[model samples]
Target: MEYIASEALINARASTVWEVITDAGNLTVWESGITAIDGELRNGGTIRIKTADAGGRTLRLRVQQMPGEVMTWTSRLPLGLLKRTRTFTLSLQAGLTHLTVKEEVSGPLAAFLGNTRPDTSQHLNEYVHAVTNRAELLDRAS
Candidate 1:
């Protein structure tokens, strides 16, 4: 399996962070990479994600929700040949929220695409930063 994971300590409550990150309607308010997404964000829902440059892709993802702690989404890539899983986990540590985001690719073609595809760490980092910023702002307003 090929994966990318990022961890950071965000100065915000886990619940607040979770709420901000999972709300698809508010995604554009924080996330820079996504142009738009349609469909409800929940278990067994289909979502259409439009990126800024790469056009768009639709994913029928199976969501695993663990409120305030973790949320995971898994889906099969086009042709059902490659599997992709994305996860976000939060933990309370020393009065701060420890946040981790990870995405993994697996399948027979995983190694090939993993090597050819550009590094996704940068995209993940952007997501984390945006989430952190939004969470902080929301926390301060409350």
Candidate 2:
């Protein structure tokens, strides 16, 4: 399991954060690594996020939970013969929010990511920075 996580406090309200986070069609508004996404927004719904990487691989993303200040999703993708599970969790705090993403690679290729993926903390840090930029949207309107 190659686990990583991040936490951030935006200079905005939870309601504002919730709106930006739940807007399924607008991931490019924050996540820098996502180029585009097309799909539905609901429990068990699927979505495809065109990542920063070229060719825009349509990742297998599904909402693990929905309805409330917290939402989660699990993304499955193959790294060679191994399958990877990436879990994203979001939680609201006092006028702030917390977001975390964890990745677990298993099967025959498990060692591939667990051994080769360098700078795990750097990825999480970038994610937090990208998502926290949502504060700009809230600030602009307010």
Candidate 3:
């Protein structure tokens, strides 16, 4: 399996951070490289995402959420050749929100496709910073 993860301590409540992450319409504002999202981010729902990294390919993901705590997006290749699951977890700590985003890639072809997978460490850091900045801004405004 391949894993990429990022975390941040934002000066915002968990609820506020959750709202920011779950708002699909404004996702592109904070999520770097994501060009568009075409569906709601509710549990048991599916959303199609267009990203600059994919070269115009749209990624379809299944959404799973645990309200203000966790949200996970899963995508799979045909015949279970590869599967990727990205999870966002939020927790309250010392009146602040602790956010963690993790992505795990696993399947029979994982080893074979290692070279083809993009290195997302930098992207993950950017994502964490973006979320923290946006959540803190909203927290201050409210």
Q: Please report the candidate that would top TM-score against the real structure.
A: 3
Task: Point to the candidate with the largest lDDT.
Answer: 3
Clashing pairs in 2: none
- Better-scoring candidate (lDDT), 1 or 3: 3
Colliding residue pairs in candidate 3 = none
Off by over 4 Å in 2: 77-83, 92-95, 114-121
Error of 3 at 105 (Å): 0.2
- Give all TM-scores, in the order shown: 0.88, 0.71, 0.94
- What's model 1's lDDT at 56? 58
Residue pairs that clash (backbone atoms under 3 angstroms), model 1 = none
Residue range with the least summed lDDT across 10 consecutive positions in model 3: 113-122
Q: What is the number of backbone collisions in each predicted candidate, taken in the order shown?
A: 0, 0, 0
Q: Provide the lDDT at 101 for model 2.
A: 60
Q: After superposition, how far is residue 81 of candidate 1 from its true place, in Å?
A: 2.4
lDDT of each: 0.80, 0.63, 0.89
Error of 2 at 118 (Å): 7.7
RMSD of each: 2.0, 3.5, 1.2
Q: Mark the regions of model 1 whose C-alpha exceeds 4 Å error after superposition.
A: 53-55, 77-80
Cα lDDT of candidate 3 equals 0.89
Residue 64 lDDT in candidate 2: 55
